[model samples]
Target: MADNDLEIFLTARNVLVELRLNLAKAVSAGYKKGETETAVKSLIEVQQAIDVIDHASEELEELDEAEHDED
Candidate 1:
């Protein structure tokens, strides 16, 4: 893989990691505070991030395919 490809992949992966960590922390905080609603809200945020990342991944795949077609 090219260096640029590796960088993009790593960045995307790091985003996922950060999102998961933030979500986990939110859940823990909500539980500690006995706030189910807040926890659920945080989950929604996490789901949105997952959706965004999934979309980004799909786009990247499409781009790669297009590049290969050009070659």
Candidate 2:
């Protein structure tokens, strides 16, 4: 648990939290507004957010492994 590692993790966590909140807002707004465009846009956003989180997870795992190897 180096300071750098902790900072990276917390930043990623915050980004994920924000992404989820936005997704929720998009879903709620799309449904309430009854717009097909909004629904499709939300779907795109969901995929993009998932991809980002997935990549971040992989990167973090690699970082963890590298840190352990150094020790």
* Model 2 lDDT tens row, 1-71: 55476577567667766766776677666555556456557667756766776676678778888989999
State the displacement of the C-alpha of residue 3, model 1, in Å, after optimal TM-score superposition: 8.3
RMSD to true structure for each model, in Å: 3.8, 4.1
Query: Clashing residue pairs in candidate 1, if any?
Result: none
Measured on C-alpha atoms, candidate 1 has an lDDT of 0.70
CA lDDT, every prediction? 0.70, 0.68
Q: Judged by lDDT against the true structure, how good is candidate 2?
A: 0.68
Model 2 is weakest, by summed lDDT over 10 consecutive residues, at: 30-39
**Model 2 segments more than 4 A misplaced:** 1-34
Task: Tell me the tens digit of each residue's lDDT in model 1 across 1-71.
Answer: 44476467658767766877776777766455546566667767766776776677777778878888999
